[model samples]
Target: MQALYDVPAPAKLNLFLHVVGKRPDGYHLLQSIFTLIDWADTLHFERRGDGRLARHDGADAMAELPEDDLCLRAARLLRTESGDAALGANIHLEKRLPAGAGMGGGSSDAASTLLALNRLWGLNWPLARLLPLGLKLGADVPFFLGGRNAFVEGIGEILHPVDLPAQTYFVLKPPTSIATQEIFSSPLLARSKSVAIVAGFPAHNSSDDKNESLQSTGAEVVKLDAQGVAKLCGGFGSNDLQKPAEAICPEVRQALQLLEARYGNSRMTGSGSAVFARVSSEEKDGMSNQSMATMLQDLPGAWTGKICRGLDRHPLSGWA
Candidate 1:
């Protein structure tokens, strides 16, 4: 293919993020479950026979982005590893997901870049070969490349396939961006002591005492209905980083309050500056698109919000 148009890099929500431990190298060991969302950034790629890689992104977004962003870094790394100096591409990114919202926008884009370039350059690399290169780009990169919901651990390198029923969410991004370091370095960060069991879960609600009785029974995936989703997620832990994120960025707290007031519950996903609430099937059916749009229009300038649905896998899952 001469071009890959409208390639999507979907954002991820950490349904539950727990800081389990710390490595001697200073990287915090974490355990979380990541699920893809319908809200995503779109990328367009065209073969560049000139051997010059170029990324055309929104000027304002570029100003906010690091000089050597993940997209460029991914492209360079893939090309170098391919041992094909002549391979190049022109990448255009339509930045839809807000930056620093803890939604994995940049990492998803980088994953998409590697997948698109693999085909553009005729490398046809398998997922196994591409995964290590993805890790070098960012901790979240490999999860995106994994192409489905995952139980993530070990600084984001360990991943196990997870299955989540399709569900709706209301995600709100505040006007400000949060630097990840600010959240991690804070002394107020909390770590969870209890480990979450994801190997098996009930498909239906159980008695109070029976809830959260999960085990490693090799029953990972299940066919669940809308009501089953709540019981399944209730067993998962909370985002430990949320405490520090709210402290480091008051906007994170503000976003949480806003979502909670409307949706009845809200939690910070991943880190800070963005909060989300689960929308029940009845709530989603009653909500109209115009209402969702009006809510977003009411936000401050450059702030974004979306009524998104959880995805079964990345839109570009088959690309790699």
Candidate 2:
């Protein structure tokens, strides 16, 4: 195919992020459930035989996108890795997701670029081949390439696919942005002991034996179905970075308070300023688009909000 149009790069929400430890290299080890949501940025790609790669801003594009955008990085990396200097693409990105919101927007876009270009160039490289290349771009890139809800660990490279229940979430993005480096480098950030999870989350304070925690949780973990996954939503675990992120961007705190008051449970996703709340599927079903619109009417004029649903798989799951 010479062209791919309107390809999707979906965003992700961290159900819960816990800093388990730090590597000798200073990279933090973490455990979290990275769940895909319907909110996405769109990309269009056209193969260029002349071997010239270019990027364009689509509707609502972010202002001042860096010259070395992830899409370009991904394309160049793929070309270099595949040894196909003749391969090139013109990529147009529709930047819907807010940067620095901990939504994995850029990483997702990069992953999508790799997937689309592989097919365009007839590389037909399997996901395993693409994964290492993706890792070089960013920690979260592999998760998007894996294309499923996953239990992620080890600076976001390790992924174990988990079936997540279908559910809707109210995702709110404050005007302010929080840098991931800032949160990770903060002296005040909490590095918690790894929390164990089975089919369900145990009480937050449980102190079970580490070996037993893994063994007992292992069987039940594999057996967890959609209903089981749904129960864990808004109930288990917490974001370790939330406090630090809120301190850095007060709007994060304000957004969380607003959602928590209405939705009972809300937390910052990934490392920053965007927060999400679990909304009942039934409640969402009963409401019209206009009703959903009014739900966020009270949000600050500078902020943006969306009612998004969790996806079992990324839209490009089978492409690799």
RMSD of each: 4.5, 3.9
lDDT by residue for model 2 (94-210), tens: 899998899999999999999999999999999999999899999999999998987787788877777766778999999888878999888878876655554433333334555
lDDT tens digits, residue span 44-110, model 1:
9888777778788765332223547888889889999988888878788999888888999999999
What number of clashing residue pairs does each candidate have, in the order they appear? Answer: 0, 0
lDDT of all predictions: 0.80, 0.83
Best by TM-score: 2
Q: Which stretches of candidate 1 lie over 4 Å from their true place?
A: 59-67, 201-228, 231-235, 300-302
Please report the candidate that would top lDDT against the real structure: 2
- Poorest lDDT segment (10 consecutive residues) of candidate 2: 211-220
In model 2, which regions exceed 4 Å deviation?
Answer: 59-67, 199-231
Q: Candidate 2: give the clashing pairs.
A: none
TM-score for every candidate vs. truth? 0.88, 0.89
Candidate 2 residue 73 C-alpha distance from true site, Å: 0.3
Error of 2 at 224 (Å): 4.1
| Candidate 2 displacement at residue 11 in angstroms | 0.3
